[model samples]
Target: MDLHYEVLGQGKPIVMIHGGGADSRDWPYLAPLLAKHYKVITFDSRGCGQSPSQTEAANYIMDVLNLLNHLSIEKTVIIGHSIGGQIATEFALSYPQYLQELVLVAPALAGFVHSLDLLESFQAIQSAAPDVSKMTELVVNSPFCSVIKDSTHSKLMRVMTEHNIRKMFEWAAFGAVWPKPPAIERLHEISTRTLFIRGTRDHEDSVKIETHFRAVPNIQFVAVAGGDHMLNLTHPEELYMNIVTFLGEPNKQA
Candidate 1:
């Protein structure tokens, strides 16, 4: 298949979507813990990890839909990080009937325009381009990610970042297609039981997005103390605990 995925454990299903510049490998530390309590599914989105690149326009929300249908997962919790969180948000908005809960960790807003400074920083990273090491350094060494720079997960983060950068060189003609009207303006429309998470050391722009998400009618927000954008790697135990608490009773398949 074009998307490489794996399922573990046995309980209510939870589909974990990794952020940009990462793949299912992003969930190694946290996935196992979650697997102990729920059926966990992790996958490499197109062009990341083992997934093949696509030449046509891609709708990640649809990708999530197709994955669920292929697995015969009629209902599942969606936990998404970074860009993956953005996809999860749109998915919840589009198909609330299919999700038991929605969790977003530092997700990007579909219609949001980042500040000029952040845009420039991203551009600078892109300018490094073919220099994979430099681009990876720019991403990992940034303030929002620096907490992991000295942690044991640093090596893994570097590897994932570099692998993601290299994958860009292999991209075919592909354009991401997000649903219209943007999730930012439609936050009030989402009625799913939602959990929003972010780290204390997260970027300023992420804070702005949180303000928009407050419009979500039924949502809870948690700030991981001393956590960074990559809290999943640096604070998996804490992350898992918060999730389980939010999930409450273990899901049962009747």
Candidate 2:
């Protein structure tokens, strides 16, 4: 599938992958800033935004690989948020030769087991089969919404969440089969330079994911003081600076 994507600027390539409930629009605030220094590619993952939905579970890694191959991009930096981060990690493991570096923002790791209560709560939400309004409200109240101080960005997030909630559910129904074999045990296999960024206000799972990545030889972890899961929207400047600094490091050269 030729997923929807847009590329901007001119320089070394940098691919930005949005979170589970978001699309390419999620990077609007940050992409242009990064574009000043590098080519930025943003895309809607399978079943999100402008991309066609699939009846079967989507292989995010393959979808990303397909996109890169379609553009004839052999190697580039991969920046991903939430589940997107999980995809980046898998790509680094499965196709390390194709990555220059990996940047994960409040990433979700495979096999980081959720509590039974949390699982039950998600099941309940799934059972309720929320309408867009209900899902928007739930998302607004979730940790993902915390620490978002900008009203305009917050509204944009709500709108995007409502727009993509149905597809999110559709993907969920297909089951959580992504990042197969789990990434926790495969961290050491990732040789690509990596940067893991977590917000202080983000969920505990992000912290756990960061902890596991510590064992990876080429990984660097940074915590944003008051940032949250949506740092690309809420703290784009800070995130951009961190990314730019990492990309500029002498050791990160392709």
Candidate 3:
């Protein structure tokens, strides 16, 4: 599959992966800021945006590995959001040697059975297939609300709430379907440094997942106050600075 990808800047590589439902366009605003420090690459995952998936079940980790191999990037810092975070986590577990660091933003690391409520909401929206306006209304007015202010909420919803493909949406729900990684059980197996960022008021599952990673031997978790699930959009400056600081931190002594 020919996945659509964009690269910016030049230096150590950083691959930015977007959450489910939304595509790589989710990174346009934030990727440029990160590019100032390192090479930044963002792309639509298969089945979303410009990339189309031929198989009913898309294995995103393979696509990610292929993308990196195609670019000849031997090592990278993977910065991923939501479902992309899941892909990144599994990638780190399966190929820890290829990653310098793993940075997750409001990741969906909690188990699929645990995230059933989120799944159900997504399913409800998929079943309804609401247009942009209606989906925007639901995003702005729902209890699952996380975006900070009306203006920011409107802006993000405007950008993300457009796709209404039910099959793809269900595919995302299933894509999100996985038992929590044994990474939780074998966090020490990962030698790469890891960073977990979450909104203080993000969904309950996110908070729990962040807490779980806190015990990972080489990981740190930072909570952004007054931020929501989509902290990159709601509080980009805060998120950006935290990432910079983490990336700049000294390596652990052997």
lDDT of candidate 3 at residue 72, scale 0 to 100? 94
Give the lowest summed-lDDT range of ten residues in model 2: 171-180
Model 1, position 21: C-alpha lDDT score = 88
Model 1 misplaced stretches (Cα beyond 4 Å): 251-254
- Cα lDDT of model 3 by residue, 1-254, tens digit: 39889999877789998986678766766788888767889998877777764355567778889999999999999998987887888788888878988999988763434567777776666566545456555555544455543544456555554652432543433442332454566556667798999888778888777766766678888899977777777777888888888888323210
Cα shift from native, residue 48, model 3 (Å): 0.9
- Candidate of highest TM-score: 1
In model 3, the Cα lDDT at residue 16 comes to 91
Task: State which candidate has the highest lDDT.
Answer: 1
- Candidate 2: TM-score? 0.91
Judged by lDDT relative to the true structure, which candidate is superior, 2 or 3?
2
lDDT of 1 at 59: 75
Residues 90-197, candidate 2: write the lDDT tens digits: 889899889988999888888778656546656655565666687676666665557763445788888887888866666634644565578988888889999999
RMSD of 2: 2.6
Number of clashes recorded per candidate: 0, 0, 0
**How many collisions between residues are there in candidate 3?**
0
RMSD of each: 1.4, 2.6, 3.9
Residue 18 of candidate 3: its Cα lDDT? 91
Lowest lDDT 10-residue stretch of candidate 1: 245-254
